[model samples]
Target: MRKKIVAGNWKMNLSLEEAQSLHSEINDALETSEFNCEVYHFVPSIYLSTLLESDQKVNVGSQNGYPAKNGAFTGEVSMSQLSGIGTKAVLIGHSERRQLFNESDILLKEKVDAALEEDLKVFFCCGETLEERESGQYKQTVIKQLKNSLFHLPSKEFAKIVIAYEPIWAIGTGKTASPEQANEMHKSIREAIEHAYTQEIAQNTSILYGGSCKPSNATELLNQSDIDGGLIGGASLKSEDFLKIIATYN
Candidate 1:
């Protein structure tokens, strides 16, 4: 069976001290609970070392990374730097990055290649804008993004990758895709994988929902056959709510 994964994306939030405190709370909660699902926390670069030292089951990850291994790129974190600090995964091509930094598919693909080359897992994100979704171009947009950003990689190299579908309209908007809606998009993305690789690879790959996922709706969302788990945003910051979401798998 594909393992369920709940990844907390603490995007552009929390200071070093606050991150340490939050990590303490999360670790304590995980220890007391019976949650067996794979858990990851994508914190800002500064807290990676501190987060890695925790004795919790939560894997360490970064919100972003530079496409180059190392260079004179000021303010850019490289894959080598991330791996050296014990990061297990990196978030790539998030909607906010696309909007704020104007990252292109080519840049994202390079980042994916760089991360995989350094043996770091990747949570590659893709989604459509509100206008595209309303115009019924959601599937097309997702397919194109997948094709451009990831499909070029060899199947063997694909094993370290996780795809997150975060509908732009729903992200941080307090709007969520219904379970059926989430399942439909997830199934379609899986089918796209099947077409690109094989059914076995498609079934084995973990696909997550990432749009305003919270305790109130996490169980319903995760219950869908194709919906493996979540890429939690705001809800992940709170220890109690995050643990409640993790309990949905238990």
Candidate 2:
């Protein structure tokens, strides 16, 4: 069975102290819950070690990592560094990175290769612009992104990857893709994977729904056959809400 994963992308939010407090709160809550899903938090690089040191059941992930193993590239975090700090996964090619940092598919592919080379799992994000969705090219857009940025890897390495589908229109806009809408896209994504790889890989890979996922709609969203879990945003900051979302699988 595909593993259910709920990953929090704490994007550029929270200070060191605030992150510590939130981590502690989340750890406390998780201990009291019976949820069996794998939970992860993608905090800033600075808080990775701090969170890893905690007794939290949550896995630590990097918001971003460089494509290089070691280089003179300033301001870039390498895969080796992230692995050394106990990062189990890294979020690559998030919508924000594509919009603000101009991260391209070529760069994202390199990052994925680097991460996998270090044995770290990858949360590979792919989605469409609002215009593309309105024009009915959402599936094509996502397919192109996945093919270019990820499918190049071997099937053995592919097993370590998780795909997150985040509609750009809904990311932080408070407008979520309805459960039906999300499932349609997720099913299409899974089909794309089956076409690119094998049906076995497609069925085994976990596809997560991102874009403002919260407690209010998590149960419905996660209950879908193709929707394995969530790549949460704003809702993940609160301990109660995060736990509630996790409870959906229970």
Candidate 3:
């Protein structure tokens, strides 16, 4: 069976103290619960070590990392550096990185290669913008992202990667793809993976929905056949809301 996961992307938000307190609150709530899916906290780089220092229930990962092991690249953290500090995973090609920071697919592929080399699990995010969606080219756009950045990897290496589909228009806009729409895109993504690799590999890969996925809509979205879990945004910042989404998997 595929791995079920709900990862929280605390994208560039919260101060160090706020980060710690929020994580602690999540941990405290989960202490007595038995969740069916794996949980991950993808926080800002500045707070990674402080959160990882403790033996917590949920895994911690970086929101971004440089492709190089180490270099004079100021303002960038390397995959090796992250691994050395016990960081288990990293997010590659998030829409914000692509649009806001101007990270191209070529650069994202290098980051995927570097992260996998260091044995860091990669949450490779890909999505379509409002224009692409409205143009009926959303599938083409997203598949192109996978083909350019992630499909090059051999199945063995690619098997370790988790795919998150975040509709760019939905992110941070208080908009969400309807459950049917989200699942349709997810199914397209899985079909693309199947064509790239093998049927078995595609079946085993976990594809997550990331948008305005809050407690209210999580169950409906997650219950869709192709959506394995979620990459939560705003809901994750609140422990109660995040926990409720996790409970939906049960």
Highest TM-score: which candidate? 3
> How does each model score on TM-score?
0.98, 0.98, 0.99
Clash pairs, model 3 backbone? none
Query: Least accurate stretch of 10 residues (summed lDDT) in model 2?
Result: 27-36
Q: List the residue pairs that clash in candidate 2.
A: none
Give one clash count per candidate, in the order shown.
Answer: 0, 0, 0
Taking the tens digit of each residue's C-alpha lDDT, what string does model 2 give over 46-76?
8888889866688889999998777799998
Better of 1 and 3 by lDDT: 3
Residues 1-250 of candidate 1 have per-residue lDDT tens digits of 7889999999989888888888888888788778869998999888888789867778889999997877799999999899988888999999999988999999999999999999999999999999999999999999999999999999999867899999999999999999999899999999999999999999998999999999999989998999889999999998889888999998
The lDDT leader among the candidates is 3
TM-score of 1: 0.98
Relative to the unseen true structure, what is the C-alpha lDDT of residue 195 in candidate 1, on a scale of 0 to 100? 98
Q: In model 3, what is the error at residue 31, expressed in angstroms?
A: 2.0
lDDT of 2 at 88: 90
